[model samples]
Target: MDEARWIQQARAGDVESFGRLVRAYQTAVYNLAYRMLGDRMEAEDAAQETFLRAFRHLDRYDPERPFRTWLLSIAAHHCIDRLRRQRPDLPLDPGYLGDEDPDPEAALIRKETRETVQRLLRHLPPTDRAVVVLYYWYGESLRGIAEALGLTVSAVKSRLHRARWRLAQGLEATDEV
Candidate 1:
């Protein structure tokens, strides 16, 4: 069935329809949370919270927009909120996620690169990091990002450019070190 039909069914108290939506989106949501939080356990918690929020607010969703986009918007908000609450003392370690690849050499290189990027990303403001992750890691288009982030397309594009520049500058500094 189409998403609209599934959403309509879910809205009408069809648990199975909602479950189908959840099953379809669980991975993407988890991946986004994981990338944002950098801890599997925290990511799991965020993912759960995302779904809970989505379910609770399902009635409020505008059917004109894509359901997945709506769902991700919720997830992104939850992750950013979580980050804010911890912003005082906690530092974002970009390499906190690390590499899962099995090849030793490849894994080592990947870890190093990820760590470097993470370190750079840590220095960036969370807003910039959020844009970079959503744009680059999630492959969200500017329009999708605008919808997910509740920003204008121009704003998202500007932020992405600044974030990329900040990341590049940080990496350059790391190389000097």
Candidate 2:
């Protein structure tokens, strides 16, 4: 698929071209939302909103920058805004597991681990959580995360460092329980 051509067409008021872009990036956008919000429904909503915002603001998009980066930037900011509106201490629902694993024991362990990680992530400030999620889950570089989240590179590094410390503390507390 020629992403540049699609982007150009989308900019020229072609809805189908935009739909193709959405199909290509939906999983990435939704996964960022899911990791940030820790709720399947909210993540889905955020992903839709991100695409809507992107479509509306296509003219503002700089062609020199990567389209995926720009899209994820919108998703990250939307999730951060949503997080800010809600109570910080609200319990995170682990949501649902994916397809059944052939090994039941392994599946259970993986579920438990995912739940634990989500719980720990819930403690982070929204921006810090976004930094960690983009860095770890998406394998985004520090510079990429900085661009995505509108933070300076040093700020991104600081947030990542602080988030790790907080997550480690959370793990220790859970271990003691």
Candidate 3:
């Protein structure tokens, strides 16, 4: 079935349809959450919460909009809310406590890059960071972001552009220093 058809079925209280929808988008949603939250456990929790919230609000979803966008918005809001409530002093490795990567060098590089971006993201306000993550990291479009955040499309575009420029400048400054 098409996404809209599944959405419609899910909205009408079809459990199987909803499960199918969840199966289809679970990885993307989890990956997005994991990147934003920087903790595997929190990401999993957030991803679960996103689908739950989306399922609860399924009736309110406008079928004209993409289903994934709607679901992602829920996950983003949940992750941001959690981040706001947490203490910054605590360590950020939220996944398996002692998990080792198979490729140590490549893993180290990825971990370092993630740490750098997370550090930079911490400097941004939640809304700006969400825009940056959704647009640049997750490849969400202006319209998708706007729908997700309940912002105007123009506002989403402007915020995304500004966030990208700021991140670029930050990287350049780091390179210089």
Considering every candidate listed, which one attains the maximal lDDT? 2
**lDDT by residue for model 2 over 1-177, one digit each (tens)?**
499999999999999999999999999999999999998888899999999999999999999999999999999999999999977776677655476789999988988888899988987999999999999988999999999888899999999999999999999988898
Give candidate 3 regions above 4 Å deviation: 94-103, 165-177
lDDT of 3 by residue, 1-177 (tens): 488888888888999999999999998898778777767787788899999898999988877777777788888888779878877665666243344679999878777776777656655656778888888867888887887888999998888777778878888776787
List the lowest-lDDT window of 10 residues for candidate 3. 90-99
Question: What's the lDDT for candidate 3?
Answer: 0.80
* Model 1 clash tally, residue pairs: 1
- Residue 74 displacement in candidate 1 (angstroms): 0.8
Q: What is the C-alpha lDDT of each candidate?
A: 0.80, 0.92, 0.80
TM-score of candidate 3 against the unseen true structure? 0.79
